[model samples]
Target: MYKVDKDLLAIQEARIHIEGAKEAAIELRNFTQEELDVVVNKMAIAIKPHLEELAKQAVEETHYGLCQDKLLKNRFACEYLPQQLANQRYVGVIKENYEQKTVEIGVPIGVIVAMIPATSPVSTTIHNAFIAIKSGNPIIFSPHPRAQKTIQRTVKLLKEAAIVAGLPEDGINYMQLVSSTSTNELMNHEETALTLVTGIPKLLPKLKAANKPFIYGGSGNGPVFIERTCNIQQAIHDIIESRTFDNGIVSAAEQSIVLDGPIVEQAKSELTRQGAHFLSEEEAMKLVNVLMKKNGDLNPESVGCSACELAKKAGIQVLPTTKIFIYEQAYVSENNPFAQELFSPILALFVEPNWQEACEKCIELLMEGAKSHTLVIHSNDEHVIREFSIKKPVARVLVNTPSTLGGMGATTNLFPSMTLGSTSLGIVQASDNISPEHLVRIRKVGYGVRTLNDCFNESGNQSLHSKDTQESIEVILRKIINEMKE
Candidate 1:
C-alpha cells in the first residue's frame, strides 16, 4: 500500500481549482451586464433560504460568534449586497465622453484567489463569490481550516445556483484540501489575477512576499469617542450594542472609548445603565492576562467570548446582565494591552480634558493598534465633528452611529460588504468596502482627436493642426503599425 503526501495533495488541489477557474473566466468575459445581474439575483435567491443552516453550522464549528448575529451577516451578504449591486454596470461601454471622443469599458480582473476568515467565513464567502461573478470573474477560495465545513458548504450551494443560472461549472469553488502550502499556490499562480484576503493578520508577511496583487480586509482597533455635546444615552447605547453584537468578533467593533472630561461622571453612569461592566483594578489585571498572549498578540481563546464568559475565565464573577467589559486606563501606550484590538466584548476607557486631548488619545490608540480601518465620534457639535474628520487617517468615520453596523453598511448608506479593506497594514491596494466595482479594471478608448505634434509643438513650433502642415493620419498610422510588426 502507498500513501500520498498531504502537502502535495493540497498543492495539486489548488492547481485544479485555479486551472478550472481560468477556463471559466474566459467564458465569463462574454456575459452581458444583464446576464451577470441575472446570475447574482439567482444566487441571492438560492442562498437566502439556507442562511440559517449555514449560520448554525458556522457557530457550531468555529464557536466564535452568536448564531443570530451570524444569520444577520448571511442576510446582509445574500439580500442586502445584491440590492446594492443591482444597478451597477461592469461591462463594455460603461461611460463615454462625446466631446473628448473617449469611452471607458469595464473589464474583469480575471480569476481571483481569495482567503476566507474563520470569524465571518460564511458571509464573506457568499459576498466574495457574488461580487466576483457580478464583475465577470471566476473566483477560488482557500477556506480557513476552522470554518472549512461551512465555507465548503457555501461554495457548493453557490456553485450549483450559479451554474444553473449560466455561470461556468467552476465559476465559484473552494479548496477541499486547505493548507498554507496550497493557499500559497493559489495566490502565486500565474493565472490568478488578484488575491482577496479577509481577517488573516498573521499571513500579512506571506501576502507581501507573493507576486500577485491582493486586497486585504484585516484587523481593526477602531475606537469610539463620546464628546461633551453628544447624546450620552444614545452614544452609550450604540457603543454597547455594537461592541456586544456577535460577542465583538467583527473587525469594525469599537475597541475602546474616549470620554470628554466634563461628561466623565455622566458617561460612566450611562455606560453602566446600558449593561457595561466597568471592571475593578484587580479584575482588569486578570482579564489583561486572559485577553493578551505572552507574545503581545490577541489571545485566541478569549475571542468572541461574552463579558460573563470572559469574567468567569479570568476568575471573576459578573452580573448575568453584563453586556460588555470595560477597563478604565489613565494613559495610552504601546505597552498597554487594552490599547490593542481584543476582538471580544471588551473595551478600554480613557477620559480626556477636551476634544483636542480626546482626539489625541484616539489617534494614539489607532497608531498603536490599527491602521486605515474605522473610527466613531459621538457628538452634535458640527465644528468638532468636522475637526475630527479632517484630522483622522481612517477609511470610514462614523458619526453618531455604532461602529459595527455603520462600518458594514447596516445602518449607513455605504456599500454593503463583508470585507472592510483596512489599508496601511500591508500589500492591500484598496481602502474601499470591497465590491464588484473594485474587482474590475477600467479600459480607456481614445479616438485620437488631435495629433502628437499638436501637443509637442505647443511651445512655438507649428503643429499639424492645419491641413497644410499635417502628415496624412492614415500614412502615419500605417508607418507606426508596420514598424511594430517588423
Candidate 2:
C-alpha cells in the first residue's frame, strides 16, 4: 500500500478544519454579544491557571524571550484583553446612528486563517482565539513548526473552555499536521474569509498571493527620538525599559535612538547609568556578524537574546548586568545592520544637530525597516510633540512612553492586540490594532436619510461665497499669472 504524501495529508487536514470552522461560524452568528462575551470570559478564566505553564513551555520550546515576560504577556492577553472587550459590542446590532438615520449590524467574516509566530506563540494564540470568538468568527491557527507543541496545548485548553461556555467545538482549531503547504492551503481555502497574520517578512509574499483579504502585522524597527525639550531621565528610562522588554522581541520596541545634540551627553549618561553597554567598533562588527545573515535576514539564534547573552555569543565580555547593547552610528541605510530591527536587546544611537535633523534621521531609520508601524517621541514641548506626531510615517507615535507597552495598549488607550496592522503605507490592509471589530463586517441600515434630488438641490442651494471667495480667486489667479510672466 502506498502512503499519502505528508504535504497532501496536511492539506486535507486543513480543508477538514476549514469546513468545520465554516459551519461553526454560521452557528456563532446566531449568538448574542452577551453570549459571546460569556464564552470569552470563560476562556480567559480557564487559560489563567495555565498561563505560567504555557509561558514556560513556550520558552523551552522556542528558546526565545524570557518566561517571566511571556507570563506577563499571557496574562495581558487572557486578563487585560478580556477586560477591554467587556464593554465593547461585537455582534448583532452594535451601533445605531439616530442622527444619520442608520443602524449598523455586525456580521462575522466567516472562518479566519491565523498564522502564529514562534516568538509569541501562546499569547498570540490566546489573543487571536478570544477576538475571533468574541466577533462570532471561527479561527483555525497555523502554528509555527518550532512552537507547535506549546501552541497546540494552549489551543486545546482554550477550545475546552470555549466549549464548556457554549461555544461550538470546532469554533477554535489548529493544524495538527503542521507544514508550509498546510498553511498555504488554509490561507487559500475557499471557506476562509480573512487571514490574520503576524510574523516575519519572508511569509508576506505568500500571504499576498493567497488572493484573499488579509490583515498583516509586518516588521517594526521603530525609532525613539529624544528632542532637546524632553525630560532626559524619563526619556532614557522609557527607551531602556521598552527596548529591553522581552529581550526586545516586540516589533514596536525601539531599534534606534536619535538624540538631539543639546541633550546627547545627558541622555548618554542616563543610558549608561541604566546599564547600557556601548559597543566598540570591533565588538559592534562582531555582533553584526552574529545577528545578521549574508542575505540580510535576522539570525533566528540571535533573536530575543539578552544583551549579556548576545555579547557572550559574539565573543565579547560584558557586565552581566547589561540591560542593553548600543552601537554609535552617524547614518542610516538598508545595508546598515545596526539600523534594522535586531529583535534583541541591541540599539543603534545617532546624535543629530537639532530636532528637525533628528526627525529626518528617525524617518530615514523607519524607511530602512519600520515603515508605517510605530515611533516614539520624548518631548514635553507641545509644539515639538505635535510636529513629530504629524510628520512621522509611523501609524502610532508614542509620546513619552515605552513603545512596546504603549503600542500594545498596556500603557495607552490603544486597542490591546497581538496582531498590529501596518495599514496601506506598509502595504497592509488595516492600520489599527487587530480587534474583534476587524474580524467582522459592518452592515449599514439606512432609512432614506435624503433623496437623490434632495442632495442635488441642497448642494445647488448652497452659496459658494465665504469670506471674499471672488477676491481670493482673483488674488490666486493674479499670483499665478505674475509667476508665469516672471
Candidate 3:
C-alpha cells in the first residue's frame, strides 16, 4: 500500500513535467538558431566552474570511477563539445543547396526523455542537456537511482542557467521523484519525443514497449587488435591507457586485446612493462567468479574499479602500480566472465595466427560480449587496417589510437559526445557519436524539376525532360527567398 502511494506520486511528477515540457517544446519552435545557441552557451558557461565539484560529488555519491578522470570527462563536455557545436546550425533553416534545388530546415524533435547513467552521471547529463537545448528540444532527465544526488544537482544547475539565458522555464528538468513506474510514465507519455538512454541496456524492453523512437548507448566489449607489424610498445601503451581511463567505465574503452601470433611474446612483455598484470590460471579463475553474478552476467558491483581495486576484490595480490588486470582467454562464451565486459581495468587476451584469424576472433568476442559496438586496430599496414575496417560489425573502428580517447573524439575526428550510439543493437537511429543534429529532424524542401510530360514519358525524349525545366529552379528559389523575407 505504501509503495503504491509513492508510485502514484512519482507518476504525478512525471506527468506534470511532461506537460510543461510539451508546452516548452512548442515555445522553442519559435526560437531562431542563434537564440538556442545562446541558451546552451550560457548553461555551459555557468556549469564550467563547478565541473570539478560535480565530478567529486558524482564519485562520492556513486562510488564509481576515479574523481580526476571524471573531471577530465566533464571538461571534455565543456571544452571540446562547445567549440564543435558553435559553428554547426541546428534550428530554423540550416541548409540551402541551390545546386540541388533543395533546402534543409532543422526541426526540433520535441520533448526528449534522457536516462542518465550512474557510471557517467555528470558528463552524460551535461551532454544530453546541451544537445537537447541546442536543437531547441525540451528535455526531462531521469536520474539513475545510484547517482541521484549527482545527476539531480547537475540538472538543477543547468536548468537555472538555461532559464536565465532565455530558455523556457520548463524547458529542462530532472525527476526528483524517481521510480520504475514514474520512468515508464515519462517514456510512454504522449509528449515524449524520444528516449535517450546512456549506458543502461536493461531499459530496452521498456523503451520498446513504449513504442517511441529511442537512441541507446549500451554495452561495448570491442576487441583492440595489435598486428604483428605494429609498434609493440606503442600498441600496448594505447591499450593500457584506454582500458584504465575512468577505471574502464567508458563503454568505448578496450575490454579485450587480440594479438598476432608471432609477436605475442614481445607484446605480452611490453604490456607487462606498461603495467598490465597478467593473472595466473588459478588467479584468473578466482577473479572470474568475482566478476560474474549468479546469473552468469557481468557483475555491476565490480564495474569502474582500478586495477589494484579490482585485484583486491578478487583476492589477488598485485603491485599498486598495476594499470590493468590481464587474463589470458581462449574461448568466448557466456559462462566466461573474461569474455564479458568487466567494465573495470581488466582485459581478456587472445592470440591469433594472423589478421584474418584475428578478425574472426574479434567477431566471436563481439558476439559473445556486447553484441556490436566498437573495434580498434593498431597497425601501420594499410591493407590489414582496411580489411579490419571492412569486416567489423561494430559502429566505430578506431585506428592507431587509444580506443577510449579516439572513440570519444578526444584523439580522433568523431563528434565530441558521451553517448556512443550502439548501431545494429536494435535501433536504426544514430550509429555515430550523438550530437545536436541527431536530436532534430531534417525538413527537406525540393522544388519540382520536371513536368508530367517528363515524368510519364515512356520513350526517351530529352525535350520533355528536366533540361527545359531547369530554368524554373531559379524562379522557384527567388520565390522562396521572397516568402522568407515576408
Candidate 4:
C-alpha cells in the first residue's frame, strides 16, 4: 500500500489555487508588446538573483553536480531565455493594419502542469514557471524526487520574486516530493489545461492518455561522427567535452563516436591526451555487456557513472583520478550492449577503416534509439555536414562545436533547452530545441468591409470577370453549358 505525502497534498492545494488563476489569466486577452516586454524583462530581472541563490541551494542540498555548472544553467534559464522571448506578445490584440482594420487576438491556455527533471532541476523550474506566467498561464511544477529540496527552495524564491515583480500570488506552485503516482495524478488532473513534460519515453503515453494537450520532449541518443576529412584534434576535443560535461547526463550528450580512416588513430591519440584512458579489449567488452541488460533497457545504476565508479563496478581498483574511460570495440553485435546510452563519462568508440563504415555505424546507432533523440557530426567540410544533416533523421545535427553545449543551445544561437525533440517516429516535434512559442496558439482576424456592398467591392470584385479574366471564365462556362446540353 502507498501513503500520500504532505508534499503531495500541498501540490493538490496549489492546483486548486491555479484553478482561479487560470480564469484570471484567460481574462487578460490582449497585451501590448511593451507590456509583454516589461513582464518578461521584469520576470527575468527578478529571478536572476533568485536563480543564483537557488542554484547554490540545489548543489548544497542535492550534493550532485558542480556549483559552477549549475550557475551556468541558471544563467541560461534566466538570461538567455528571456532575451529570446522579449518583445513577443501573447496578449489580447495585434493590429495587422489599421487601414485594413485587421486585428489578431491572443488567448491564454489557462493553467499548465510542468513536470521537470532532476538533472536540470532549478534552471527548468525557473524557465517553465516564468514562461507560463508570461503567457498568462498559472503553473504547477512537479520536480524529480531526487531534487525536490532544490525545487521547493527555487519555487519559494520564484514566488517571492513574482510577488515583488507585482505578479499574482501563488502564480507559481510546486511539489516538494515527487513520485510516479503523484506525477500521474498531476497529468491526469481534469483541471490541467496543458502539460509540458520533459523526460523519459515511458511517461509520454500517460500524458497522452490524460487526453489533455501536451508538449512532451523525447530522449536523445546523440551520436558524434568524425569524418576522415575533418580536423582530428578539434573533433576529439569537442567529442570529449560533449561526452563528459555534467557527467554525460544531458540528453544532448554524445553517446557514441564513429571515427573513420587514418584519423581514427589520430583521434584516439588526441582523446588519450585529453585524459581519456583506453580500456583493454577484454575490460571494454565486459563493461559493455554488463551495462546493457538483457531486456534492452538502460541500467540506471551504470548510467551517468564516473570512470572510477564504472571501474569499481567491474571490480577493478582503478585510480580515482581518472577523468574519462574509453571503451574500444572492433564490431557492434547483439551480444554487445554498447548500442545503449551510458550516461556516464564512458565513451564508446567505433573505429572504421573508411568513412562509409563510420557513417553506416552512425545511422545504425541512431536506429537503436531512433525517435527519441539527436545525432552529431564534427566536420569542417560543408558538403559532409550538409549530407549528414540532410540524411540523418535525428532532430538536431550538431557540427564543429561540442554537442553538449551546441546541441543544448548554450554556446550556439539555437534556443537553449534541456529538451530535444525527435520527429522520426512522432516521439516529439522535429524541433532541435523547444521554447515558450511552442506552447501558444494565435487567432488571426480578417477585416476590410463593414457593409454588404463594401464586402463585394473589397472581396467579390477582386475575382470578377474583367476583360482579362473573360477568356478563362468563358472556357469554364462553355464546359458547364456543354455538359448540361449532353
RMSD of every prediction: 6.6, 5.1, 6.7, 5.5
Instruction: Give lDDT for model 2.
Output: 0.87
* Deviation in Å, model 4, residue 29 alpha carbon: 3.6
Per-residue lDDT tens digits of candidate 3, residues 1-486? Answer: 344588899999999999999999889999998998899899999999999999999988888899999999999998779899997898888999888799999999999999999999999999999999999999999999999999999999999999999999999999989899999999999888899998887898887787788998867888999998888888888888888898999989988989899998899898888998999999988887787777777777887878787788889999888998888877777767677776888888889999899999998877774457889999999999999899888888999999889988999999999999876666447878999989999999999987665544534364533754455556767898999999
lDDT of 4 at 296: 70
Worst 10-residue lDDT window, candidate 4: 453-462
Count clashing residue pairs per candidate.
Answer: 0, 0, 0, 8
Per-residue CA lDDT of model 4 for 1-486, tens digit only, reads: 989686667556655655755664654444444554565577677678676677777766655555667788788888888877776666566446778777876666767888877667888787787677667666788777767888877777777766675556656777655667667777767777777876656777786577767776656666788887787888888777777776677667787788877786678878878778888877776676556667877666675566777777876655566668777777665445665666677777888777567777777778774543777777777887887877776677877888878876886888767665665544232355766555556688887556543333445444454664566567878998999999
Which lDDT tens digits does candidate 2 get at residues 130-195? 999999999998899889999999999999999999998899998999988898899888889988
Query: Over the stretch 1-486, how does candidate 1's per-residue lDDT look in tens digits?
Result: 899899999999999989999999999989999999999999889889899999999999998989999999999999888988888898777899999899999999999988999999889999999899999999998999999999999999988888899999988888999898998899889999999998788777888888568998868888889999989999999999999889999998998999999999999998888898889989988998898888877788888888999988899888889999888999988888887777799899999999999998888877775565889999999999999888887777899999999999999998898899885766676886888888999999999865566653454356467664455555667898999999
Q: Candidate 2: lDDT of 126?
A: 93
Give stretches of model 2 more than 4 Å off: 1-4, 424-427, 449-486
User: Once all C-alphas are superposed, what RMSD does model 1 give against the true structure?
Assistant: 6.6
Pairs with steric clashes in candidate 3: none
